[model samples]
Target: MENAFLNSLVVGAVLLGCAVFSALAGDPDALFDFIVPPGVMPANVSANNFTFRATKADFVAGKLIVQKISLAELPTLDGAGVSMATLMFPPSVADPVHFHQRASELLQVTSGSLFVSFIDSLGRRFDQKLFAGDAFLFPKGMLHYQINLDPKKPAHAVAVFGSSNPGIVLLGPTLFGSGLNVEVLHQSFNISKETIEKLVAANTPHPL
Candidate 1:
């Protein structure tokens, strides 16, 4: 009886440790095996299996299309701890400057070419030109943008994230369209109020 009690205590300690680690790492998938207690599969496992297909409705007319899969869409992926999306950029189109707060992204170009640029934490800029079958990595929380290089052909790429939910923030919309005080933006950007107003106005009706 004493041995059993000590073993139970050990197991409890291990579980507590795992819980703490999962919280710190932001990886709930790490606790999947322990939480599910073995032999019991999650209900959504079968239902969530799917194939991703991109169509006209998936894109924003002439710009880009992103088809994403995440934990919110498929709970079964909780064990996988990763999410992905496919991006389609029409010729001469560009994705706005953006960043992912919760995860880093790896983009693999499947067809055509892409011109990608990013700014590091120190405000240093890096640019790369990717061709078919090329890949690039964008560090988490860094500002980045992508432009389709081919004016006659569309480009296709797959982006994988380290976290289930990779939060995205578009720089222009978040800054100009977020309804923050116009004076603050003017001061922060070192631009005149008229310039700020024009920028805000341009970003209001249509966000790039």
Candidate 2:
């Protein structure tokens, strides 16, 4: 009984250490991924899975285009803990305010310029204008956005993430388009019911 208790204590301490490390690193995937719990095989074992290619469509431009190459698109990246996305912002367009759940993003401007900003947990906002070859880091789980300041040309960038499955949570869509009750929004934002409904209607995605 004493031996069993000591083993359990060690296991508990290890788990607690992992949890604290993951929280500090903003990488919850580390807990299960690093230890390689039972039945988990090594990623990208097959030679064919070793390569990834980006095509023209990946860089296609739109209002606020984001073509991501995450674990969902490449199963080989399942254990890699890394992913990338292409960003194209059309003239005067802006990427929606969003946050990555699992990974911080490093956005590097490739062409044109962009106005970038992020809001920290304390609600303090930071912003800057990034030109070609400039980069910005958005801390994990912080709300961030970027806008193409050029009036006639589009801006391009690439975002590198530290997690294979970095999940995006868009503020507008989450708030207005998720069938949230009108009363909830009205109370939260102190906005009129009509305005809230209009926002919901505008943000709701149409069946494609």
Candidate 3:
């Protein structure tokens, strides 16, 4: 697990180091936020700095959503060492392989159920089927994924992170859609060119 975490950090740094720099520099042109890092206080708000509230809408876009609330959503969370996110899975939908660069995740099912798994340093996979009220932990930087296996009802889970801002690194996007060279992927996975091109095509991103 430790080694896996370290490897993930290296990959994240290689891919997203500029994202981190841009966020710190407050560059609005960043492709996406790597982290809304904590400890920076919010400015120009009303005197009432006592509390904050957030609902799914605060973090979600539409019916199709996987959302998180960090310092970006609630400035009060700055320095609080905590953040929350939600996973809403339509039946048979997958929230595929991904990792958090900064914090461990503790996720609790709130509706329906899902199967979750993580791969450790030694390549040993740990997985579980969780029903509502069940919880699982994935240590920081461990590659992991979740799937809603049900055929009918939707599933939902809530996750809490140990850091105020935990950024995600997704495997599919990183490998197939992020513009990593084809030769590198072909050699690393030792897969055929046809298969590689198919995966790249499947994962290619299109603007909304």
RMSD of each: 9.0, 7.6, 11.2
Candidate 3 local lDDT, 161-191, one digit each (tens): 9777677887886789877788999999999
Sort by TM-score, best first: 2, 1, 3
Q: List the residue pairs that clash in candidate 1.
A: none
Worst 10 residues of 2 by lDDT: 31-40
lDDT of model 2, residue 119: 99
Error of 3 at 179 (Å): 1.4
Winning model by TM-score: 2
- Residue 107 CA error for candidate 2 (Å)? 0.6
TM-score of decoy 3: 0.70
Give the TM-score of each candidate.
0.75, 0.78, 0.70
lDDT computed for candidate 2: 0.83
State each model's CA lDDT, in order: 0.80, 0.83, 0.77
lDDT of 1 by residue, 1-208 (tens): 9999999999999999999865766455464442231344656334225433334545555778877887666444556658898889998898889998888889999999999989998999999999999999998899999999787899999999988777788888788887879989988989899999888887753232
* Candidate 3 structure lDDT: 0.77
Q: Give lDDT for model 1.
A: 0.80
